[model samples]
Target: MARPVWSGALTFGLVTLPVQMFTATESHTVHFHQLQRGTSDRVRNKRVNERTGDEVPLDEIVKGFDAGDEYVVVEPGELEDIAPGRSKALEITGFVDLEQVEPIFFDKTYYLGPKGKEYAKVYALMEKAMAHTGKAGIATFVMRNHQYLVAVKAEAGLLTLHTLHWADEIRDPRKEIGDLPAEAAVTDRELKMAEQLVETLSIDWKPEEFHDTFQEQVAKLIEAKRTGETVEKAEPPAASTNVVDLMEALRASVDRAKSPKDRRGQKAGGAAKTAARSTARSKRPSKASSFDSLTKAELYERATEAGIPGRSSMSREDLIEALRGARGRRRADAS
Candidate 1:
């Protein structure tokens, strides 16, 4: 079970409900420790005094702000003293239509649950009410000595709190971004073609079908290095479409999207040609050279043809090994 990060009372219009907050998301990215060059020793950071060149203790460290000439120092205990009641309470100012809140304002999310089983009814009632009305409660609270603007909404039969950026934190894109094109830059014909392309490529949202291919490649690279093997480098990015060929590019993209089977057939044809070449070369008494010359995609195609289980998850080397094992099994059956 996950432990709650905070426990507090949620107040709204004279009603108080005890609740707990838990982080809603976690990261899975691979992490590496900093090390000294040409050595396995780990590199670490420490707070040190500039003039004396001595390592500073945590208890002695205080927050400082640079003024004109000197520094203004503040103690950590002073911050807590000022936020006396905010740490223990989450007060909802008002409810607003959920759709009114722009996605740009949202930051982190946390799950809000009843502090005890006794307060389950109140929690459920709030969640159901907000879910039905399509409203979110705008709230403010202090956590870890930082104040956060937040929105509490009902999601998947539970209340979720999302931290929001303060109004001043948002930047004006017009002032921040340069060289943005005007609407008049696009021709009517190009706009229609672009719309058509979008329509042709539209599909229902299915997040499960997508994954982090870059992370998968990183894992494969690590495994390959550990096993003293080389992993294939990724293909280079395609050249940018020229403005003169914009219409032609849009037309070609629409045509390709309209006929997905044609694209699949092209890939299948390439794989079939590779297989045929391999078979023809096998009779020349050079069997070892056949699979080694094929690319990873070609090997994957052959694995697919052989109906190898778990081939989709296999690396290029794994696919080659599996294909070899399959070929040997077939030869044994034939004999």
Candidate 2:
């Protein structure tokens, strides 16, 4: 059971729905300790006064904001009183179509669920309205000490609050992405080829298909070091750099993605070939497996029928081998 981090009522006209905020993400990074290079002595950070260059006691420490090199000491009680969310309420102004929102503005997400039994109907109504219309609520909310531009979105039958970035926070890529050479001209053939490549690579959203492979590999490498094992690291894939010939690169990528490994578990009889496909296990054996590929379930049944005790407890690999032997014996008896 998750405890609510915050409980608040959203105000849209006269409609008010009691909602609670819950953290959307959980960090799973293994905790590590800093230690001396030679000895295993743990190292610790010390609190020191930067202006005086002296170590300060825990009780003596105070926070101060530098105003033009002059320090303005901030009192804890005063800051808490001025904190935006002292009231702990979210006031929604109105909703807008999701298409109007920029992807760059999205920052952090929090799950919002009904606070009490009385709020359930209103919450559901709001969720359904947004989901049906493909719209998101533009809300103003404060959490901790910061006022946020928030978007209330319906996801998986519940309302989710995504804190958005202010316009000033986004850097204008146009600053670096300047004009190309005046003489640079794209032919109609080139444009057509580019469009075709884009169409081939276009995909539907499937969040589970994407992961932080670099992070996973780093974790594996750390585990290897911990277990006193050495493993060869795979070389990084080649990157495309010639923007002038981007269509050429995309053409190559599209061709490569059509290969056996890339086409696995995908239905190729439609448009949007790159759209993520769910790899559902087939009840019938795939052609790639032994004797027209037997499923683990079928193999286990075969093993049991052959008087292999505890076949149900056997692993998939064991079942496959056992079932193969059983089938071989049956074939031998027929001869």
User: Which stretch of 10 consecutive residues in model 2 shows the poorest summed lDDT?
Assistant: 273-282
Tens digits of lDDT, candidate 2, 25-134 = 98766567999999999999988788988999987766789898799997756666876656476877788889899899998899998888888899999899889999
What's the C-alpha lDDT at position 45 in model 1?
94
**Alpha-carbon local distance difference test for all models:** 0.82, 0.71
Candidate 2 ranges beyond 4 A from true positions: 51-61, 176-184, 237-251, 259-335
TM-score against truth, every candidate: 0.78, 0.68
TM-score of 2: 0.68
Which one wins on TM-score? 1
Give candidate 1 regions above 4 Å deviation: 260-335
